[model samples]
Target: MAGAGEPGREGSGQEPLLVFRTMMRRLRAECPWKREQTHRSLSRYLLEEAHETLEAVDALAAAEDAGDPRRRDAAASHLREELGDLLLQVYFHAAVAEEHGDFDLDDVASGLAEKMVRRNPHVFGPDPVAHDDATSVDDAWQRIKAEERPRAALLDGVPATLPALLLADKALDRLARAGRPVEDLDPDDLGDRLLGLVAEARAAGADPEQALRDAVRRRV
Candidate 1:
């Protein structure tokens, strides 16, 4: 009694969505190893796939620089494949969540949608953003975020697990968003400070994070 719309059929059944469900079912049924996976076990695979995707993006940029049409096309295909791998990781994670009865892909999607709507009041609601200085827009966004989270510490939102360079960038961005007077520091002085810190890190064989954290702790 298989219908056209059914999986492997023509009509009269629920249309088989070739999406997360199909992938999940295939993983659960056909893939014995995929069925045995837990979130903790799959974390490394997810990170590896993400890094591969980043590599593909970097390759695409390099191909663009060379102006090779064939390389560019190949890079694009690689990028798409890498992205699909990343999407699979997302679905795999969602499947794990579904097993736990916590939340699934729909919840993840809905939560992101809600967060986007909440954050982008200008885009989604009546209060459209006015044309202003970049600093002003950033300040307004931070203010909105602060109102939403109401964190005790200013650095609460920055992910601690981010790479050191990215973490430092986020920290600086947060400070800038809060209207800190970085303009007061001379460009030469800033350059010198950064160079001196790099030299010190090289000399001491110390992590820049440790040095930066110590300095922040002393000041704060």
Candidate 2:
């Protein structure tokens, strides 16, 4: 095992990802806390790290908007740290699985790369797809996904545990894609009204979840 600062075995080039995976494996073996963690146990940390990364993204955007070079640099560093923390969750889960003879980080990464190549026919396939714009590209991607999971329900892969606003946004998007868009709005009912707002946000090309978070932040 290589020490933190010492790059081990000259002439054997070290990739950061492989090094990180090795570090995670060692942590799982030697660290008491990491040793005890299961996939179920690490779920909360994963979620928390994801949200922290989001916050770091917002901060970086704000710093850029403010035109502060120093602030932007600091924000970028914070975002990178947050991203690394989130990635730790991934490697942690992979290490846990590797221990049980399930899967490892390489398996997870390879599957993702394969999925991206499979989905983006315009970029990687033998017969390239012609997409005029981002919307068309997204449409093509969704179509490929649908074909891959034939006979799946509209909400089959949509997690019910998503934030209410985001859940409504995805549900509405699915309905619109299926040509069963929710045209009827009920202002009197809170849920329907909120869904309507989410639809409006979607049309305006905004993230309702982040918009609401910003609004609440301004209020407090």
> Top model by TM-score, which number?
2
- The digit string of per-residue lDDT tens for model 2 on 102-190 reads 98777998999999999998999999978889999999889999998874688989999999999998899899999998977888999
TM-score list, all predictions:
0.70, 0.91
Report, for every candidate in turn, its global Cα lDDT versus the true structure: 0.72, 0.89
Off by over 4 Å in 2: 1-13
Error of 1 at 142 (Å): 3.3
lDDT of 1 by residue, 35-71 (tens): 8999999999999998899779867877987899999
Error of 2 at 166 (Å): 0.6
RMSD of 2: 2.6
